[model samples]
Target: MIQSFRNEKYDHKVEILTPISGQDHTYALLATYEGLAEMELQNKKMFEDEEYKELITEFFLQNIVQGSMTTQLFRTMTGLKKETNSQK
Candidate 1:
């Protein structure tokens, strides 16, 4: 599925989300690539981190939990406290 949202503040900018698909979920290759691109933009550092990449790969191999993946990526990138667990 393609998820898109608009922000009035960004005016011309539109946010499109394409999360990865798990074994149970069927997703288009283009959509998954788009999601990866979005994640890269959101968290460049996390993508660059080898350890983080491995963890993410493992998580995806197990299941593509879009919400969890996105949330973790965002939190890791923003250095914000996680919803369930706080990180220093």
Candidate 2:
């Protein structure tokens, strides 16, 4: 799923990956700014709380397929394309 939101005068895109095997959910948000870069550089955080997972799940559902081609391009560049393909 993809979601777009404006931050710091630049539009940011979020891509959420929900695994079919019940693994921890992962997401990547991309934007043309240092803050986004910093977020990407940070260590991955996994959510064990049901409420947190539900919140994130709802967010992803609302934002699904709402992003532009550029977001998809970034997802590809970030290696999610390959990961998606392999998962299928």
Candidate 3:
């Protein structure tokens, strides 16, 4: 499933995270977009993809817990620049 997302070449970053300490049974798929517009566009593209739809129907819908998914969005604070190696 992770590979499917990467292969699609969407204009966003995707990461898969597993807990080191808490919630051992939980895994997370983190997708970072430039903004809400990008998120919506990418999501639409993803949903419209036939491969994605097949995977969701064949795998995710069967294995994942019903209603267990949750979504949260966060924005970086304005004026905060990402720290680079050169600035360290």
Kindly list the per-residue Cα lDDT of model 1 for residues 1-88, writing each as its tens digit.
1122122311223344355655544342211223556645645654666765776578577767556433222222446555755533
Runs in model 3 lying further than 4 Å from the true structure: 81-88
When 1 and 2 are scored with lDDT, the better candidate is 1
Candidate 3 clashing pairs, residues 3+ apart or interchain: none
lDDT for each candidate structure: 0.43, 0.42, 0.80
How much does each candidate deviate from the true structure in C-alpha RMSD?
Answer: 16.9, 14.1, 5.4
What lDDT does candidate 3 reach at residue 37? 95
Better of 2 and 3 by lDDT: 3
Residue 54, candidate 1: alpha-carbon lDDT: 73
Error of 2 at 76 (Å): 22
Count: clashes, candidate 3: 0
Candidate 3's residue-wise lDDT over 38-64, tens digit each?
Answer: 899988987998977787677776768
Task: Give the poorly placed runs of model 1, Cα more than 4 Å off.
Answer: 1-42, 65-88
Error of 1 at 76 (Å): 19
Q: lDDT for model 3, on a 0 to 1 scale?
A: 0.80
